[model samples]
Target chain A: MPVITYRQALNDALAEELERDGNVFLMGEEVAEYNGAYKITEGLWKRFGDKRVIDTPISEAGFIGLGVGAAMMGLRPVMELMFWSFAYVAYDQIINNAGCVRYMSGGLINCPLVIRGPANGGTNVGATHSHTPENFLANTPGLKVVCPATPADAKGLMKAAIRDNDPVCVMENTLLYGDQGEVPEGDYVIPIGVADVKREGTDVSLIAHGRAVLTCLAAAHRLHEEFNISAEVVDLRSIRPLDEQTVLDSVRKTHRAVLVDENKPFCGVSSQIATMIQEHAFDDLDAPVQRVCSLDAPAIYSPALETQQLPTADRIIQKVLAIS
Target chain B: MSVTRAEKPKKTGKNPVDYAKAPINADLTPEQKLGFLADMLRIRRFEQASLKLYQQGKMGGFLHLYIGQESVAVGTLALMGENDHAITAYRDHGHALVVGMSMNECMAELLGKATGCSKGKGGSMHFFAPDKNFWGGHGIVAGQTPLGLGIAFALKYKGLKGCCLTYLGDGAVNQGVFHESLNIAALWDVPVVYIIENNQYSMGTSLARSSAIKSCLAERATGYDMDWDIVNGENLYEVRAKTWDAMQRAHEKCRPAILEIDTYRYYGHSVADANAKKYRKPEEIEFYKQNHDPITLWENRLKEEGIADEAVIKKLDDAAKKEAAASVQFAEDSPFPELESVFDDIYYEVDMGTESGKTGRHFFND
Candidate 1:
């Protein structure tokens, strides 16, 4: 096993996929010469040259739709957005074109496309730049939404997304990009829509995805150390074809659950998880299911306000304690 | 020299050079002329049958008849190679027929039967046949513009010698994505021919009321530094010749260009809006039908040139009607998709198992 940062894992996956398939090309604003706004695509342009590592104009709708069209024409295009929040400008392309093309085409065409970039709040970049759109994208039937919480999962899922015949949205977080974790050396892929139980416990299950998985793990550690309570942390690496059976099995084992998400509470990812648990494992639960989510309001620009608005380890611990 | 705050730039009148005259090239052999006439008549007959079926409650959802805009699709698509691709907005039945989609599959799609081009998933507004290189029948206005550009980008990327012909309505010109697509297409030199089928009215509102610039929609291409030309869409020869030139430029030079085809729609926006009298006068519809019908114009030309006599024209008309009725019968005979199939095709591979377990991929058909 080798340790690598989450950004490096993404870069490695992209580099490997580009090397493996000549048709797989990366395009986005500031991705080529600028080394990406976040530098996740750093040194790829130098490695692959201009044709494969294409730097597009600052037009999300234009380039994303182009990627979908290319995918239809038998080319695998990996398109990047500066931030997932910018996807709003190109929502019609992503939601209408890429998401519905295969179904609309009667399976005659498949958009083997990956639209990846950072998609979380914690950066103090204000409401416009900060958006967790996994819930919104997951709502679309033709799309696969994956949010990996670890470097290994990021690397594996990115490769899987590129290889999949359908369109897959890879939702990354800015805060988690720098976090380092153990990743396998050879060609590996953690399949999408599978949950990883980071910590095993019998008291309660803390289910989360993406960055919220980190908060859940931290909360699980504190629950065991301070309160003598063993909390299970289930990382839902993929959101769309959500691993419902795994979450239900975890809930059935612990008989208590807390759904944690960085997205707002109303009609959010946490809400969906909590509903699933209550619907499937109600009789097995010892207490009511709790949710730790961001406040239902626009993310403020101020550092303190933003920090208070998002979910944290303290919030997950409190939810766990409440249902324990 | 610094200018004062009160010094204002002088306003000038519209430039005369902005109004460039459209090119005219009406040179066609007797065989080619007859082919164009037959193509336009087939679409006309298909649209006529579709209109009748909707009235009899055989189909559900919106039915947009490509009645008057036949030449735009038939002429432009005549230049496409087998490898070339095309995409268009909701006014797409004509384009599908022109791109060689069988009338049986298209009618089945309209009827929501399992044997449709889209397997009963996409209805009239979303018809697609990628095998024929017809990308789709997009519902959202101007939605296919960027997708078309992407297809062209792929053609260039793969080193293919074909262009992507993307069609939009007159109203789609107002959409922001349409402009965005043009800017990128010109910037990257993507091989695409963006054909604006200006069918007089976008839905109910006429082009005069909807468009900001009154003179010509092709002039908008100048802003993006791309070549543009307007064509008499009702004239088969003019439409075909101009589009042929544009498509050649796209294929040979990898240049993106715009072609604004002046055409009209005889019916209302959709079949649902039968009372088109509310928007426009009956005489206006009658005027275009009588004077500017693309099928009639080509038929008269063939007769004048002694290419087709009354009997030959009658035989073609009879064959078109027969084929259209057969398509309707095929649609009515096709069965609906199975209930279990609704969950299929959502993903190419499902059942993605974790690293701890060796769960195999679950393909839909498997």
Candidate 2:
């Protein structure tokens, strides 16, 4: 095993997949020579050549649909959205064709395409560039939404996403891309829809994803050391085919649950998990389910406002300490 | 600077500027012309049955029948190969029939039966037969134009000689995505043929009531660095010949072309508005019926060619009616899916040892 950044792990996974199969290629804005704006696809164009590592002219809907059409043929394409916001232009393709084509056509046609991008707010990019889209994408069925919180998980989950015969939205976060972790070398795949327990405990179940998972983990450590809350941290790797049993089991043991989300509070992942818990594990809960979430406001460029709008490590700790 | 000379024009009475160079021979076999007429009559008969069903209260929802636009797809798509892809707006039954969908399936779809083209899931505006490469019966006005360009790009990437025929309303030409797709098509030289089915309304608004630009809409083609032509939709031969003229160039040159087919709708927008006269004159409708009926024009051509006589035409019409009836019966007999199927077909799991991708799966279990 080699230690690598989360972004490098994604790049390495892409490069390995490209090297393994000549039919697989990459396409997006700045995915070639310039690597990627996030440099996750660095040195791929030089290694794979222009035919495989394509540089598209900033047409998200056109090129994304082009990838879908190509995937319908024989080629496997990894389409990169420069940012999560670019999806607004082509949500119809993702929602209507990429996701629903297989089920709607009764399995005659499958859209085997992967759309990977950096989602969730942390780097102080305001408003349009800095909103978490877990709920927006999760609301639509027939698409797999995977958000990796670590380097090894990023590599393994991306390979699994690319190899699977369905459309997947792999969301990486700006804050987690630089974090380093041990990744098993060469040809590894993580199962989709399976949540992993990062820190085990017996008091409260803290469910989170993407960047919010990091905050929850930090809060879990603080709870154990300072307040003895014994919080169990669950990083929900996949959003759409969410692992319900693992979450409910954790809640069943802990007797309370809190969902740490990076998006606004109104209709975020907190609501979905809370509703599911209510439906499945109502009698097990000793206290009402709590949610540590960002306020209903845009992430303004001002660091102060962004800090206010985003879920912080301090906030997660406070939520756990107060309830404990 | 280049000479920048315009093509010569011919005198044809009303705004007659004829564009022809060298010699033009728009000829097909008499049998083939009859085949096209047979195709159009299939659409006419099926839609007529659909109108009948609507009257009986068997059909519901927005039913936009393609009563007068038969020649546009019949003429144009007849020139295309089976690999060539096509997409169009919700007023799409005619194109679906001409492209290869059976009258039975279409009629069943209009009736919202399980045996419909989309397996009864997508009704009316969302039919897709990928094997046939009939991309969609898209309902979102201009949404398919850019997607059509992307499909054409895929054809180029695979080195396949496939062409994309994307049709839109004259009203949809105003969408920003249309202009964006045009510029990209021009820039990349994507093999696409954009046909504007100009029936002079965006849901009830007329062209004059809406626009300041008063020229043959094809004139906008110059801005996109594309070759374009306009045709009388009533003349199937002219519509066919002109669309092929543009489509063939797109194929050979790998560049996009636009063709505007100036047509009229015999009925109102939907079946419910059959009596709509606030927007159109009754006399104007009658004039078009008498002069510019696309089906009648083809019927006359077939008689002139002496390839199909009245008995043959009658047989064809009778066969269309029978086939449509059989399809309705099939749909009625077909059962809707079980309740659990609603959650199925969502994600694709890797099944091993098939013709699809394999060999690396089944490695993990805990």
Which one is best on DockQ?
1
Q: Tens digits of per-residue lDDT for model 2 on A1-324?
A: 789899889998998899887768899999998989899999999988977898887878767776776676556789999988778888777777676666555555677789999987767777788767778887776677889999988998899888877788999987788899999986878878788888899999999988788888888888888887798999888876677888999999999888899877888877888888888899999888889888777777888778767887788887776676
DockQ of each: 0.49, 0.38
Judged by TM-score, which candidate is best? 1
Q: What is the lDDT of residue B352 in candidate 1?
A: 29
lDDT tens digits, residues B187-301, model 1? 9899999999888788888878998886578778988989888767777776766787788889899999988888889888998986777889999889888888888877776
Which candidate wins on lDDT? 1
What digit string (tens of lDDT, one per residue) describes model 2 on residues B1-366? 011225312212122422212123234666777788888888888788777888888777777878878888888877778558887777888888888888667766666666677656666666667777777776666767776886787777777786898899888887766776787788778888899998887677888865556445666678888877777777666676677667677778788888888887887788787456778898987987787788887777678767777898898888878877777677667666556555555555632233222322212111
**lDDT for position A131 in model 2:** 62
Model 1 misplaced stretches (Cα beyond 4 Å): B1-29, B350-366
lDDT of 1 by residue, A24-136 (tens): 99999999999999999999999999999989888898889899899988899999999999999999999999988777777777778999999999889899999999989
